[model samples]
Target: MTWRRALSVALALALALLLLLVVYDRPLRLMPWRKRSAQPEAAERRTNRGPALATLGRGKGDGVDLFKGEPLLGEEHIFFVETSCALDKPQHVPYDSESGLRLSPRGACAVEAAAAAHPTHRVYLVHTCDVHRRSLAKDAAPAYALAALSIPNVRLWAVPYALHFVGTPLQGWLASGALRASRWPVVHASDVLRFLLLWKYGGTYLDLDVLMLRSLGEKKNFGCAESPAAVSVGAFNFALDDPGRRVANACIAELLDYRPDLWSYNGPGAITRALKKVCDVQEVLEMTEEMCGGFRLLSTSTFYAIPWQNWNLFFTEESSEEIMMMIGKNLAVHVWNALSHNTTIYTSSEQPYAQIARRVCPNVVAAVGDTM
Candidate 1:
């Protein structure tokens, strides 16, 4: 009787142990703060991140490929664009994004500025489509990306903006069938991607035209003022898990609710609408330190020292000592590249932008090599 009982108990224990092993095999990693997924990028992300990730709080976005937006040593600075070809569709192949993704010399200067100014921060040049490292070396815009990639803290994030990561409130709105695919043009698509990046990663966002002259300093949450009366999301900083980002994530859902003129529907107008309500201020310029986006409104002199209308002065005017002094005061300079991209100019040191870029972000000019 004793032998039979012992054998029976042993068999029962074996069965229970096997079942426990099977269950625990998958669930054991869920025990505590550790969350490393099967993907190599996830592992790399884990190794690459530092104190900033701890500061960001690894509560929700711990696993999966979708959560590629991880924190590194310092802060993440994001930049994005949609190619003219990608505007009308949901899915974007690499070719669709190549046009705008390629970096011109001026665009490269912008990248160099940010990377050099905030050497410790993680600078991410995000794009939609497949951009190869070799391919980037062949052209002007890609030279910027390649140059930026040369830095340990800088990387390129090539996620298919609207095509992938259909998890945001903005994606839900897009899928709601409010507007036909034709209505979602490149400009609108770009705007949509920018909001998603801010909501997901919660870092600073900048336009490709901006050149950082100095470190962003203590202020971590703010947007630049295009004018005394208007705020532009061109140069912006928002922390990860920020509620204001959530508000922007939600507000941009109405992107196609009513289409206006191109710029009004997708560019500054879109940001104006979202930030106004999020910051709880009627006038963007009137927003104060206590306010949301207004908390750190960098005046036009801070970013857009020369307004768009006077964009020519950047090229025509020489960098005399006095002008250089004024430019030095600003943290970054927006060269108004959008307005000037098409206009041809013999890029030389005589141009204020080229001069400043050469001084602050030499890689941009170096990337140009003998061509410059």
Candidate 2:
């Protein structure tokens, strides 16, 4: 009697376990397993079956893919164009945007100066920002556009800016990664910009926060400003001219393709991934910190030094004044104070006011020049 009862209980337990496993199989597949999915691969084929731009950044309808298939990193124009093209939409206009379509006078001036300074170089205003400033009303943006039109050498490109909702799939993917988990969304965006720029322009990537004290064309080699090894490359401030572009582009492409997941939240990982592809990257690093794109202040000789407070200075200061000063002297400041996003350029003297920037960088002053 006892044997029969025990056998029956064991059979029931086995059946229950089998049922549970079957129920969870599909859900487990939904998780990020090492195995590849047949779905995304198949979908990619279906969606991309027709003729497509050789790259994802450059979409159709933006005129000829003159830069198509040809590497993007070395050519500044292609970089700007491709990035602008990828981000350019007719303006979807997000709901929470506080500022509308307005460009600060200071911002306009900088664009003008950039264009005039580099007439042959194809200067562009690559704006990765959102919509809905009371200042940026429909009427206002047009005025900004008009001002931009008047600027001799500059063109403007914009993305309908919005906060990266942490709950979204992309953000979630980033947060889940081991390498990317430490960084904020802004870092992710900055890295994305790097890939975009490297893929598109490859010459030099300026963090939007940078004030552009002067033209960076003079720097011949890879310009890497100084920060810590962890934060140094600044990816934004970094510059990769003609040859480096090819290396960076191939490296970035490989990283994106091989570990698209790493691109999710890991800025440094993306950079690391790119660096791994090049054999002589160190020689390139030796050229100029300015080209490397960190906090190398623009001067007669490019030196390696932290801009002001990008990495750790902010942590020490009770007030943000020091940071503001850094923002002022440096063309861009990493405004990564927020937990979830990277720092945006201090275009205005609003809260987190870059008063020092107002004083030193005329371009910064000019962008917000109209502000009192």
Could you estimate the TM-score for every candidate? 0.70, 0.44
Q: List the residue pairs that clash in candidate 1.
A: 87-186, 94-130, 102-141, 103-140, 103-141, 103-142, 104-141
lDDT of 1 by residue, 1-372 (tens): 699999999999999999999989866645332454445363336432211111111125421122233434334555544344343443433322232344466666676777777776667666554444333333323454455556555555554444433555556656654334435455565665666666656677788788888888666667777876666767776665455554556446545454633554665666666667777789877666667643467677888777888787777655445566767677877877668876544445566766786787677577666333
Off by over 4 Å in 1: 1-43, 46-75, 80-101, 133-145, 176-184, 241-260, 318-322, 344-348, 370-372
Model 1, position 153: C-alpha lDDT score: 58
lDDT for model 1, please: 0.59
Model 2 residue 210 distance off true place after TM-score fit, in angstroms: 1.0
lDDT for 139 (candidate 2) = 28
Residue-level lDDT for 319 in candidate 2: 50
